[model samples]
Target: MCKKGNEVDKDLHSLQLKNFMGLLVPHQRQIHAFILYLVVNRADADDILQETLVEMWNKFNEYKDGTNFVAWGLTIAKFKVLQFIQKSKNYRFHFDPQLLELLEHEAIRKNGVHTHNERVEILKECVSKLQTKEKVMLDLRYEKNLTFEGISRQFGVSVPAIYKALGRTHARLAQCIKLTLEQRGVA
Candidate 1:
Protein backbone atom coordinates (compact mmCIF):
# COMPACT_ATOMS: atom_id res chain seq x y z
CA MET A 1 0.00 0.00 0.00
CA CYS A 2 2.81 2.44 0.87
CA LYS A 3 4.65 1.77 -2.40
CA LYS A 4 1.44 2.16 -4.38
CA GLY A 5 0.70 5.45 -2.68
CA ASN A 6 4.19 6.74 -3.51
CA GLU A 7 3.72 5.90 -7.18
CA VAL A 8 0.39 7.67 -7.21
CA ASP A 9 1.97 10.74 -5.63
CA LYS A 10 4.75 10.77 -8.22
CA ASP A 11 2.20 10.46 -11.00
CA LEU A 12 0.17 13.31 -9.59
CA HIS A 13 3.26 15.49 -9.47
CA SER A 14 3.99 14.70 -13.10
CA LEU A 15 0.45 15.61 -14.10
CA GLN A 16 0.68 18.88 -12.22
CA LEU A 17 3.98 19.69 -13.99
CA LYS A 18 2.35 19.13 -17.37
CA ASN A 19 -0.45 21.46 -16.42
CA PHE A 20 2.01 24.08 -15.24
CA MET A 21 3.88 23.87 -18.50
CA GLY A 22 0.71 24.45 -20.50
CA LEU A 23 0.24 27.70 -18.63
CA LEU A 24 3.90 28.64 -18.88
CA VAL A 25 4.46 28.20 -22.61
CA PRO A 26 2.16 30.99 -23.76
CA HIS A 27 4.00 33.72 -21.87
CA GLN A 28 7.55 32.46 -22.33
CA ARG A 29 8.59 35.03 -24.92
CA GLN A 30 7.36 37.89 -22.80
CA ILE A 31 9.19 36.50 -19.80
CA HIS A 32 12.46 36.23 -21.69
CA ALA A 33 12.04 39.72 -23.11
CA PHE A 34 11.50 41.00 -19.59
CA ILE A 35 14.74 39.39 -18.50
CA LEU A 36 16.52 40.84 -21.50
CA TYR A 37 15.19 44.29 -20.67
CA LEU A 38 16.73 44.05 -17.24
CA VAL A 39 20.06 42.40 -18.08
CA VAL A 40 20.66 44.17 -21.44
CA ASN A 41 23.29 41.61 -22.54
CA ARG A 42 21.90 38.87 -24.77
CA ALA A 43 24.12 36.14 -23.30
CA ASP A 44 23.53 37.14 -19.70
CA ALA A 45 19.80 37.55 -20.36
CA ASP A 46 19.70 34.01 -21.78
CA ASP A 47 21.47 32.65 -18.70
CA ILE A 48 18.99 34.42 -16.45
CA LEU A 49 16.06 33.02 -18.43
CA GLN A 50 17.50 29.50 -17.94
CA GLU A 51 18.01 30.11 -14.25
CA THR A 52 14.51 31.53 -13.89
CA LEU A 53 12.99 28.54 -15.66
CA VAL A 54 14.85 26.15 -13.40
CA GLU A 55 13.78 28.03 -10.30
CA MET A 56 10.17 28.09 -11.49
CA TRP A 57 10.31 24.33 -12.11
CA ASN A 58 11.86 23.57 -8.75
CA LYS A 59 9.30 25.66 -6.94
CA PHE A 60 6.38 24.52 -9.04
CA ASN A 61 4.63 22.91 -6.14
CA GLU A 62 4.46 26.17 -4.27
CA TYR A 63 2.44 27.69 -7.09
CA LYS A 64 -1.34 27.57 -7.08
CA ASP A 65 -2.35 25.66 -10.20
CA GLY A 66 -4.70 28.19 -11.87
CA THR A 67 -2.99 31.40 -10.74
CA ASN A 68 -1.07 33.84 -12.92
CA PHE A 69 2.09 31.89 -13.66
CA VAL A 70 3.61 34.76 -15.65
CA ALA A 71 3.45 37.02 -12.65
CA TRP A 72 4.92 34.33 -10.47
CA GLY A 73 7.61 33.62 -13.03
CA LEU A 74 8.41 37.32 -13.31
CA THR A 75 8.78 37.57 -9.55
CA ILE A 76 11.35 34.79 -9.66
CA ALA A 77 13.01 36.40 -12.66
CA LYS A 78 13.27 39.71 -10.82
CA PHE A 79 15.13 38.09 -7.97
CA LYS A 80 17.49 36.33 -10.35
CA VAL A 81 18.13 39.61 -12.16
CA LEU A 82 18.86 41.29 -8.86
CA GLN A 83 21.28 38.51 -7.92
CA PHE A 84 23.08 38.86 -11.24
CA ILE A 85 23.36 42.58 -10.76
CA GLN A 86 24.74 42.10 -7.27
CA LYS A 87 27.35 39.61 -8.44
CA SER A 88 28.32 41.67 -11.45
CA LYS A 89 28.99 45.03 -9.86
CA ASN A 90 32.09 45.38 -12.03
CA TYR A 91 29.92 45.04 -15.13
CA ARG A 92 28.07 48.05 -16.41
CA PHE A 93 24.35 47.58 -17.05
CA HIS A 94 22.15 49.79 -19.22
CA PHE A 95 19.97 50.75 -16.29
CA ASP A 96 20.68 50.90 -12.61
CA PRO A 97 18.61 48.87 -10.12
CA GLN A 98 15.89 51.50 -9.68
CA LEU A 99 15.34 51.83 -13.41
CA LEU A 100 15.14 48.08 -13.81
CA GLU A 101 12.43 47.83 -11.19
CA LEU A 102 10.37 50.54 -12.88
CA LEU A 103 10.85 48.89 -16.25
CA GLU A 104 9.90 45.49 -14.88
CA HIS A 105 6.69 46.79 -13.35
CA GLU A 106 5.77 48.69 -16.49
CA ALA A 107 6.49 45.74 -18.74
CA ILE A 108 4.45 43.43 -16.56
CA ARG A 109 1.61 45.91 -16.74
CA LYS A 110 1.80 46.14 -20.53
CA ASN A 111 2.13 42.43 -21.31
CA GLY A 112 0.23 40.81 -18.49
CA VAL A 113 -1.76 37.86 -19.80
CA HIS A 114 -2.46 39.56 -23.13
CA THR A 115 -4.76 38.21 -25.81
CA HIS A 116 -2.02 35.95 -27.03
CA ASN A 117 -4.15 33.25 -28.60
CA GLU A 118 -6.41 35.76 -30.26
CA ARG A 119 -3.41 37.64 -31.60
CA VAL A 120 -1.99 34.43 -33.03
CA GLU A 121 -5.30 33.71 -34.72
CA ILE A 122 -5.40 37.21 -36.13
CA LEU A 123 -1.82 36.93 -37.35
CA LYS A 124 -2.50 33.61 -39.11
CA GLU A 125 -5.51 35.06 -40.84
CA CYS A 126 -3.56 38.12 -41.88
CA VAL A 127 -0.74 35.99 -43.24
CA SER A 128 -3.09 33.71 -45.14
CA LYS A 129 -4.90 36.64 -46.69
CA LEU A 130 -1.67 38.11 -47.99
CA GLN A 131 -1.23 38.67 -51.73
CA THR A 132 0.58 35.66 -53.23
CA LYS A 133 3.78 37.55 -53.82
CA GLU A 134 3.76 39.11 -50.36
CA LYS A 135 3.05 35.69 -48.78
CA VAL A 136 6.04 34.21 -50.61
CA MET A 137 8.21 37.09 -49.52
CA LEU A 138 7.13 36.61 -45.90
CA ASP A 139 7.89 32.89 -46.08
CA LEU A 140 11.31 33.58 -47.54
CA ARG A 141 12.20 36.24 -45.01
CA TYR A 142 10.73 34.65 -41.92
CA GLU A 143 10.25 30.91 -42.45
CA LYS A 144 13.50 30.55 -44.38
CA ASN A 145 15.19 33.26 -42.25
CA LEU A 146 16.65 34.79 -45.38
CA THR A 147 18.25 38.21 -45.57
CA PHE A 148 17.01 40.91 -47.97
CA GLU A 149 19.89 40.20 -50.32
CA GLY A 150 19.23 36.48 -50.23
CA ILE A 151 15.54 36.94 -50.87
CA SER A 152 16.33 39.33 -53.70
CA ARG A 153 18.65 36.80 -55.31
CA GLN A 154 16.05 34.05 -55.08
CA PHE A 155 13.28 36.30 -56.42
CA GLY A 156 15.51 37.78 -59.13
CA VAL A 157 14.97 41.28 -57.79
CA SER A 158 17.34 43.99 -56.57
CA VAL A 159 18.05 44.05 -52.83
CA PRO A 160 16.61 47.56 -52.55
CA ALA A 161 13.45 46.43 -54.31
CA ILE A 162 13.18 43.45 -52.03
CA TYR A 163 13.65 45.68 -49.00
CA LYS A 164 10.91 48.01 -50.15
CA ALA A 165 8.50 45.15 -50.80
CA LEU A 166 9.23 43.59 -47.42
CA GLY A 167 8.67 46.91 -45.65
CA ARG A 168 5.37 47.49 -47.41
CA THR A 169 4.26 43.95 -46.67
CA HIS A 170 5.14 44.34 -43.02
CA ALA A 171 3.22 47.59 -42.72
CA ARG A 172 0.18 46.08 -44.41
CA LEU A 173 0.28 43.07 -42.13
CA ALA A 174 0.57 45.30 -39.08
CA GLN A 175 -2.48 47.26 -40.14
CA CYS A 176 -4.44 44.12 -40.85
CA ILE A 177 -3.54 42.67 -37.50
CA LYS A 178 -4.49 45.84 -35.69
CA LEU A 179 -7.84 46.01 -37.46
CA THR A 180 -8.50 42.38 -36.71
CA LEU A 181 -7.63 42.87 -33.07
CA GLU A 182 -9.88 45.91 -32.90
CA GLN A 183 -12.70 43.93 -34.42
CA ARG A 184 -12.16 41.31 -31.77
CA GLY A 185 -12.33 44.14 -29.21
CA VAL A 186 -9.00 43.20 -27.68
CA ALA A 187 -8.15 46.71 -26.56
Candidate 2:
Protein backbone atom coordinates (compact mmCIF):
# COMPACT_ATOMS: atom_id res chain seq x y z
CA MET A 1 0.00 0.00 0.00
CA CYS A 2 2.87 2.39 0.82
CA LYS A 3 4.53 1.65 -2.53
CA LYS A 4 1.23 2.24 -4.34
CA GLY A 5 0.77 5.53 -2.52
CA ASN A 6 4.29 6.62 -3.49
CA GLU A 7 3.58 5.80 -7.14
CA VAL A 8 0.40 7.89 -7.02
CA ASP A 9 2.28 10.83 -5.52
CA LYS A 10 4.92 10.61 -8.22
CA ASP A 11 2.30 10.55 -10.95
CA LEU A 12 0.55 13.59 -9.48
CA HIS A 13 3.84 15.47 -9.19
CA SER A 14 4.63 14.76 -12.82
CA LEU A 15 1.19 15.94 -13.93
CA GLN A 16 1.51 19.16 -11.95
CA LEU A 17 4.92 19.91 -13.47
CA LYS A 18 3.59 19.30 -16.95
CA ASN A 19 0.63 21.60 -16.32
CA PHE A 20 2.94 24.26 -14.92
CA MET A 21 5.07 24.21 -18.07
CA GLY A 22 2.01 24.43 -20.30
CA LEU A 23 1.04 27.70 -18.63
CA LEU A 24 4.57 29.07 -18.13
CA VAL A 25 5.82 28.54 -21.68
CA PRO A 26 3.21 30.82 -23.19
CA HIS A 27 3.75 33.64 -20.66
CA GLN A 28 7.57 33.57 -20.57
CA ARG A 29 7.92 36.38 -23.13
CA GLN A 30 5.55 38.66 -21.21
CA ILE A 31 7.35 37.94 -17.97
CA HIS A 32 10.77 38.59 -19.55
CA ALA A 33 9.54 41.86 -21.05
CA PHE A 34 8.22 42.99 -17.67
CA ILE A 35 11.56 42.22 -16.03
CA LEU A 36 13.48 43.89 -18.87
CA TYR A 37 11.42 47.05 -18.62
CA LEU A 38 12.09 47.33 -14.92
CA VAL A 39 15.72 46.17 -14.72
CA VAL A 40 16.96 47.83 -17.97
CA ASN A 41 19.99 45.53 -18.15
CA ARG A 42 19.47 42.58 -20.44
CA ALA A 43 21.88 40.24 -18.64
CA ASP A 44 20.50 41.06 -15.20
CA ALA A 45 16.96 40.90 -16.45
CA ASP A 46 17.62 37.48 -17.98
CA ASP A 47 19.07 36.21 -14.73
CA ILE A 48 16.07 37.59 -12.84
CA LEU A 49 13.75 35.96 -15.31
CA GLN A 50 15.39 32.57 -14.78
CA GLU A 51 15.15 33.00 -11.02
CA THR A 52 11.51 33.97 -11.40
CA LEU A 53 10.82 30.84 -13.40
CA VAL A 54 12.44 28.61 -10.81
CA GLU A 55 10.63 30.34 -7.96
CA MET A 56 7.36 30.04 -9.79
CA TRP A 57 7.90 26.33 -10.41
CA ASN A 58 8.73 25.67 -6.79
CA LYS A 59 5.51 27.41 -5.76
CA PHE A 60 3.45 25.89 -8.52
CA ASN A 61 1.42 23.71 -6.18
CA GLU A 62 0.22 26.85 -4.39
CA TYR A 63 -1.02 28.38 -7.61
CA LYS A 64 -4.74 28.09 -8.12
CA ASP A 65 -6.01 26.97 -11.48
CA GLY A 66 -8.19 29.29 -13.63
CA THR A 67 -6.39 32.37 -12.26
CA ASN A 68 -4.38 34.71 -14.50
CA PHE A 69 -1.01 32.98 -15.01
CA VAL A 70 0.58 36.04 -16.55
CA ALA A 71 -0.38 38.19 -13.58
CA TRP A 72 1.02 35.67 -11.17
CA GLY A 73 4.23 35.41 -13.17
CA LEU A 74 4.57 39.20 -13.38
CA THR A 75 4.11 39.50 -9.65
CA ILE A 76 6.96 37.06 -9.13
CA ALA A 77 9.06 39.00 -11.63
CA LYS A 78 8.40 42.27 -9.81
CA PHE A 79 9.60 40.78 -6.54
CA LYS A 80 12.66 39.32 -8.21
CA VAL A 81 13.47 42.72 -9.70
CA LEU A 82 13.21 44.31 -6.28
CA GLN A 83 15.49 41.67 -4.81
CA PHE A 84 17.99 42.18 -7.62
CA ILE A 85 18.02 45.94 -7.13
CA GLN A 86 18.51 45.49 -3.43
CA LYS A 87 21.43 43.10 -3.83
CA SER A 88 23.33 45.05 -6.48
CA LYS A 89 25.19 47.65 -4.38
CA ASN A 90 27.25 49.04 -7.27
CA TYR A 91 24.34 49.94 -9.56
CA ARG A 92 25.08 53.71 -9.06
CA PHE A 93 21.46 54.67 -9.82
CA HIS A 94 18.78 52.94 -7.83
CA PHE A 95 15.12 53.60 -8.27
CA ASP A 96 13.17 54.85 -5.27
CA PRO A 97 10.99 52.08 -3.90
CA GLN A 98 7.85 54.09 -4.54
CA LEU A 99 8.96 54.83 -8.09
CA LEU A 100 9.76 51.19 -8.70
CA GLU A 101 6.33 50.22 -7.46
CA LEU A 102 4.71 52.71 -9.78
CA LEU A 103 6.75 51.42 -12.74
CA GLU A 104 5.79 47.84 -11.91
CA HIS A 105 2.14 48.83 -11.85
CA GLU A 106 2.46 50.59 -15.19
CA ALA A 107 4.29 47.62 -16.71
CA ILE A 108 1.51 45.31 -15.58
CA ARG A 109 -1.08 47.60 -17.09
CA LYS A 110 0.77 47.74 -20.42
CA ASN A 111 1.97 44.10 -20.47
CA GLY A 112 0.38 42.18 -23.30
CA VAL A 113 -0.69 45.28 -25.18
CA HIS A 114 3.01 46.00 -25.97
CA THR A 115 3.19 44.88 -29.57
CA HIS A 116 6.77 43.76 -30.44
CA ASN A 117 5.85 42.46 -33.89
CA GLU A 118 4.14 45.71 -34.81
CA ARG A 119 7.21 47.66 -33.75
CA VAL A 120 9.46 45.47 -35.89
CA GLU A 121 7.21 46.00 -38.91
CA ILE A 122 7.18 49.74 -38.28
CA LEU A 123 10.99 49.74 -37.95
CA LYS A 124 11.28 48.07 -41.36
CA GLU A 125 9.16 50.80 -42.86
CA CYS A 126 11.30 53.45 -41.20
CA VAL A 127 14.48 51.81 -42.51
CA SER A 128 13.05 51.89 -46.02
CA LYS A 129 12.60 55.66 -45.74
CA LEU A 130 16.36 56.24 -45.48
CA GLN A 131 18.27 57.69 -48.48
CA THR A 132 19.82 55.26 -50.98
CA LYS A 133 23.34 55.95 -49.70
CA GLU A 134 22.21 55.57 -46.11
CA LYS A 135 20.51 52.29 -46.99
CA VAL A 136 23.61 50.91 -48.66
CA MET A 137 25.79 51.83 -45.70
CA LEU A 138 23.35 50.22 -43.27
CA ASP A 139 23.23 47.06 -45.37
CA LEU A 140 26.99 46.84 -45.56
CA ARG A 141 27.41 47.32 -41.82
CA TYR A 142 24.49 45.21 -40.66
CA GLU A 143 23.76 42.63 -43.38
CA LYS A 144 27.30 42.04 -44.55
CA ASN A 145 28.62 42.31 -40.96
CA LEU A 146 31.54 44.52 -41.98
CA THR A 147 33.76 46.40 -39.53
CA PHE A 148 33.74 50.23 -39.40
CA GLU A 149 37.14 50.26 -41.09
CA GLY A 150 35.75 48.06 -43.87
CA ILE A 151 32.71 50.28 -44.31
CA SER A 152 34.92 53.40 -44.47
CA ARG A 153 37.10 51.77 -47.09
CA GLN A 154 34.09 50.81 -49.20
CA PHE A 155 32.52 54.30 -48.89
CA GLY A 156 35.88 56.06 -49.58
CA VAL A 157 35.38 58.26 -46.49
CA SER A 158 37.01 58.64 -43.09
CA VAL A 159 35.96 56.27 -40.29
CA PRO A 160 34.47 59.22 -38.38
CA ALA A 161 32.25 60.08 -41.31
CA ILE A 162 30.90 56.55 -41.40
CA TYR A 163 30.29 56.72 -37.65
CA LYS A 164 28.57 60.11 -37.95
CA ALA A 165 26.35 58.99 -40.80
CA LEU A 166 25.38 55.81 -38.94
CA GLY A 167 24.68 57.79 -35.77
CA ARG A 168 22.45 60.21 -37.66
CA THR A 169 20.75 57.30 -39.39
CA HIS A 170 20.09 55.65 -36.02
CA ALA A 171 18.62 58.85 -34.57
CA ARG A 172 16.43 59.31 -37.65
CA LEU A 173 15.24 55.72 -37.46
CA ALA A 174 14.40 56.05 -33.77
CA GLN A 175 12.42 59.25 -34.41
CA CYS A 176 10.62 57.69 -37.33
CA ILE A 177 9.65 54.62 -35.33
CA LYS A 178 8.38 56.76 -32.45
CA LEU A 179 6.36 59.00 -34.74
CA THR A 180 4.86 56.07 -36.58
CA LEU A 181 3.91 54.36 -33.34
CA GLU A 182 2.30 57.58 -32.12
CA GLN A 183 0.40 57.98 -35.37
CA ARG A 184 -0.97 54.45 -35.09
CA GLY A 185 -2.05 55.13 -31.50
CA VAL A 186 0.22 52.36 -30.31
CA ALA A 187 2.90 54.39 -28.52
TM-score of each: 0.63, 0.67
CA error at residue 62 for candidate 2, angstroms: 1.1
lDDT per residue as tens, model 1, 108-151: 76575355566577789988989998988988888999988899
Scored against the true structure, residue 15 in model 2 reaches a CA lDDT of 96
- lDDT at 104 for candidate 2? 81
Query: Given candidate 2, what's the lDDT at residue 44?
Result: 89
Model 1, 158: alpha-carbon shift in Å? 6.2
Question: Mind sharing the TM-score for model 2?
Answer: 0.67
What's the distance in Å from true for residue 50, model 1? 3.5
Q: Which stretches of candidate 1 lie over 4 Å from their true place?
A: 4-16, 29-48, 78-114, 147-149, 156-168
Candidate 2 per-residue lDDT over residues 104-160, each given as its tens digit: 888876655555567569889999999998899899999999999999999799999
**lDDT for residue 186 in candidate 1, whole number 0-100:** 57
Q: Please give the distance, in angstroms, between residue 10's alpha carbon in candidate 1 and its true position after superposition.
A: 4.9
User: How much is 14 displaced in model 1, in angstroms?
Assistant: 2.9
The CA lDDT of each predicted structure is 0.84, 0.86
- Tell me, by lDDT, which candidate is best: 2
